[model samples]
Target: MSTIQQNIELAIERWRSESVSQHTLSDSSAYFRLAESLPLTDLDAATTLAEIFQHELTFIPTSRNSGDWFIWNGIIHAKDEKNLVDDYLATEFANALKKTADYATKYLADSTMSDEDKAAGRKGMADLYKYARSIRSAGGLNSLKTRIRYEFQQAPDFFDHDQRWAVMSDGRVIDLENVDEEPLAPCPERPVSRHLGVSQSGQWPAPASLPTRWAQALSDWTPDKEVQDYLRIAAGAALLGHGDAKNIVTLVGLSHTGKSTYINVLREVFGTYAGELPPTAIVQKYGGATNFEQHKARGKRFLYLSEPQKQRTDDAFLKALSGGGDTITTSKKGQDGVEWQAQCVLHIAANHIPEFDTSDDAIVGRMNIVGFDHVFSPESMQRNKNLVQELIEHEGSGIMFWILDGAREYLKLGHIPVPTSIRKRSQENVVESSAALMWLKEMVDSGELVIDPDAYMKDMITPKDGYAMFSRWCFDNGEQLPTQKKWLKDIEAFNHMPAERKGKRSDGHARVWGVRQSAHRESRKLHLVQDGGSTDFRDLLTQLETVPTVQ
Candidate 1:
């Protein structure tokens, strides 16, 4: 016999032999499994698998039970290891479970599917499992996960992103995908993606009451009004399902400044919606050279990098995340790299801010730095031993409202406005934060201006020419080379005038540069200076070096 035929016959024999116990195997499961065993075309293999097997089996119908269930019996001359053949009688009850699951998933995913169809799908899943039909599924995504996991033994990795479907703070599923019915089962592996917290359930917690104790404790402990405002913005962005305004929000301070505590509060507030808080940054793996965790942040909405000691950030990865770049390459375990848009935001809180020396515009644009200088007394913290738990459990709906309201205001504000202190702190954090800005600031301080972008220009050089000179300047200074794009963007960032002006220079009627170097004594000093006025810059760097390093 042919290999395909042999395979089909063998599968049938195994089925018949196993069902000697009188198993009423459903046609779908039998057909699906037996037909799948063929190595060749399903057409011929299925015919042999089904027809030959059915012809060999015997059915003895019972008069007592409903016709919905069939009491079919079969026997097989199966042998044991000792080659002792016997007439084996076997039995199992198989129904249209696979068909029911297929129907249920199809209806659940079909946005335009009718309510009746949807209800049938729900009923199928509910009948199969208790959680689907329970009240616990009404709030968040955890129950949804539980049901899917229970049915399929694996996690889901896709959902419908087109419809902007989300589990709201109240836990009622809202899908741009779903119209009439409430939100239903979310599979985060096909169209888009989804995730739920470990401790969260599908049921929205009891009417989201306020966490007055937590709030009061926080206010009493860290009395910085700016910190309070920032907390609101951070929480709001997380709840509203939007990226942070600053793209990357960093909370920098000594330990006990509530960095971890605040993050825990956010976790409590967001519950199942909160994402994994990684101890190290993705780029910081392998001593900040390789990205071993590119897949870690793919489906997460809120990514927390807590106490990341290393300064190395994956510029391309972070840029894509910060809205600085459009796309990022992601890698799954043993999979090829795939590109995805930045639908997620990041929060990197550390005792010491990270530094970057890269020249990518996408990298430089992701600088939202906040410093918490206050160090709460250890004695005060000791008294509130269970404060974190109390806030998470008791704060109820009050924290929800606070965060949602903050989200509303955040939408109106366009982007989170960087406080001056944060901006300065950002400058201190990175070695190559903005070389152009640093140079400009240095020149201003030294009263030795070289190329004042703010000044109107008679020298209008081409962008290409300007990059050549800038490249040389950066190379000689042993600094990160400025790309043409970053050079232009830096000028724009500082609001310099005559950004791309056309003007005549010493070579009469000849275009030079938009922001030209002045024809003066100080301008000549730029050519003479070797260290770019290192004396003053050294002092500046010294002050910035106050942040201690920890391994």
Candidate 2:
């Protein structure tokens, strides 16, 4: 028989002898395995591989467009012996092709073969090697990978690590091995890409009975029992990637307050799911280097920033990342951007509260500022220099369990209870950062400013005119004037909306703010007159009455 015909017979006989009693040919994988065992020509083996095995392996294209291929091992798209699935396939193909080529070459040396038979076998061997050479050429593996992407009916989900998934919606851990088995059956619509580094062991210890180092650290970091409990709850919330709280947690204190130590421990415990909080998330846009830093937050559950500069926070970015349910888009240079709901919760360790536009109530509502006031003494600080590592090394699982407990409690509560101290700190820091609001408070407190709805008919302060007045007040008081936009935002936030009027300005139309200083403030009146508003502004102030300040 010709080499091809002879090899086909040998393959069938080998399968019949070794596997027919055990498995039917209808089993595609078993049949493929039988074919692999035969000394078939390279071309035939490669074709057989394509026909039976292509569907078993999947191709996953990553964000970087690297040729990352995975194999569908009936359960998950997994790697082959820690190598990309393509690598394993190429090695297997090369080895099998070499064995078959050697077999075909040996057959050509048969002295008993007739001249015509040898000539036909030589032609068949040449054709097999020619096709096999094409398979081994450049781009061959890539072409195979491309076919997998386009030919497969179902595209394999990327980023699933086959261990832990992103925070479970119900806060329960599901065994991925048994994902389709039980009460948690009905697989997730999309695989969760992020996982906790450590799994929760069993029942968590009571708060008072936590690991000694952890309890002591918590107590030292936040002396208030409520705040201490809130810290645990926050950790739990972070563990589950729960952003529903819509709040950014800041641990504020001076050095030696154990804040850094606690955050360090938390970072170690969080493992692969935690990343350094991106500077873009904390700093003002256009003020820092951004190499698509936000993209690093992808698949992370907790993001921690240490001692960010005391600049105005990126309010919108912070809100979105902190769980406002806003979509965050990240792009690499020369690449299309990817958009997803940000699942990571941010924790900041700050020596002081970062500034934010005080007018944003959403920003205000989202602030969960916890104080780390209890300073560790010099001796204690020295002793605990290595405490964070020790805690993680020995009490890592216990800490994870504690965080898990907090997560369960957070789910049950439906909200994290804002400790009294957190509320107080948040309010104090917001007020301190807003000079516009502070100026307003000073004016109202000093009986120099009043909110009069009737002022529109008399001393109508157009929002621009209001800004001019505010500018003069800031100049006179040696306080820097905030941007006009922010000043207006603050004014509106203080419940002062703009009212429309015709024939109210030189332009004959205006949107006047709902606030004004008392007409009796002679200095403000003179300043307004001197500010070149003397023509219309002087007359407007004349119509003002000494109205009592509205609380």
Who wins the TM-score comparison? 2
Provide the lDDT at 50 for model 2. Answer: 47
Model 1 weakest lDDT span, ten residues long = 84-93
Ten-residue segment with the worst summed lDDT in candidate 2?
177-186
lDDT of 2 by residue, 442-522 (tens): 766787677665555445455655666567667777887678888766656555354443234534545445566666675
- What is residue 281's positional error in candidate 1, in angstroms? 5.3
Instruction: Please write out the lDDT profile of model 1 over residues 162-235, one tens digit for every residue.
Output: 22544444334434322224445533222322322222233343224435676676575446566576667666
Runs of candidate 2 exceeding 4 Å displacement: 1-85, 100-130, 139-142, 145-157, 160-194, 200-209, 278-290, 310-316, 332-336, 356-365, 381-383, 448-469, 479-485, 494-551
Model 1 ranges off by over 4 Å: 1-157, 160-171, 174-211, 217-227, 244-246, 277-281, 284-292, 309-312, 335-339, 382-385, 427-432, 450-454, 459-551
What TM-score would each prediction reach against the true structure?
0.54, 0.67
Candidate 1 at residue 256, lDDT? Answer: 70
RMSD of each: 17.9, 9.2
